[model samples]
Target: MIRGVLEMGAAGFLPKTASPEIMMGALRIVLSGGVYVPAQAIASGSEMVLDRLTERQRAVLRLALKGMPNKLIGRELGLSEGTVKSHLSAAFRTMDVRNRTEALYAIAKSGARI
Candidate 1:
């Protein structure tokens, strides 16, 4: 896992043995635009695949990640509802995910910056 983290150029690697303070620090780093890798890969057993998105797709996903509704996202991005849906579908396809929950898991597990 450490090897993968280093190879992926992630921001941090934390072992389960780390203290609560250290874990919190890792979360803070991740929240502040950094990556955090655990002692092992995610139990979901998937490789980090955050690099697979286009810029637009990444933007949409970021809004989605913030728990925005499709309508709100459309309004904020100056897009139509249908276009938002289209972008969402394309983003899901690009991430190979079936739904928002799965996409969120992938994003968190991958430590995706977008």
Candidate 2:
């Protein structure tokens, strides 16, 4: 649910059980152009960073995660190598990762289901 809300571009989410102080903090963060994702959502594995990716980016990432090289990933996806690289760059940025290893670690840490 949290992932879905975030995927829809919501700046933050607060459960009904949130205390007023927590809600106020979340609101303040959102108002200041920040995104607030509660630790509970992350702990529960509902804060998938991949939720920010487009379908093509996810497809590219899926193959890349399989240890496929860029050329092969592009060939399999019917995209040019440059296109594949572009998608990966965008995906890395969206996931706030610096490289494939970091992206993989982040994905694993988030417990996102591919």
**TM-score of candidate 1 to 2 decimals:** 0.56
Off by over 4 Å in 1: 1-48
Clashing pairs in 2: none
What does candidate 1's lDDT look like per residue over 1-114, in tens digits?
554554465555678788998799677756655455442443333445556677777787677655566788899999988888898898898889876546655665675456
Candidate 1 local Cα displacement, residue 32, angstroms? 25
Q: Give the Cα lDDT of each candidate.
A: 0.67, 0.73
Best by the TM-score measure:
2
lDDT, candidate 2, residue 55? 92
Which has the greatest lDDT? 2
Structural similarity to truth (TM-score) of each candidate:
0.56, 0.59
Show how many residue pairs clash in every candidate, following the order shown.
Answer: 0, 0
Give stretches of model 2 more than 4 Å off. 1-45
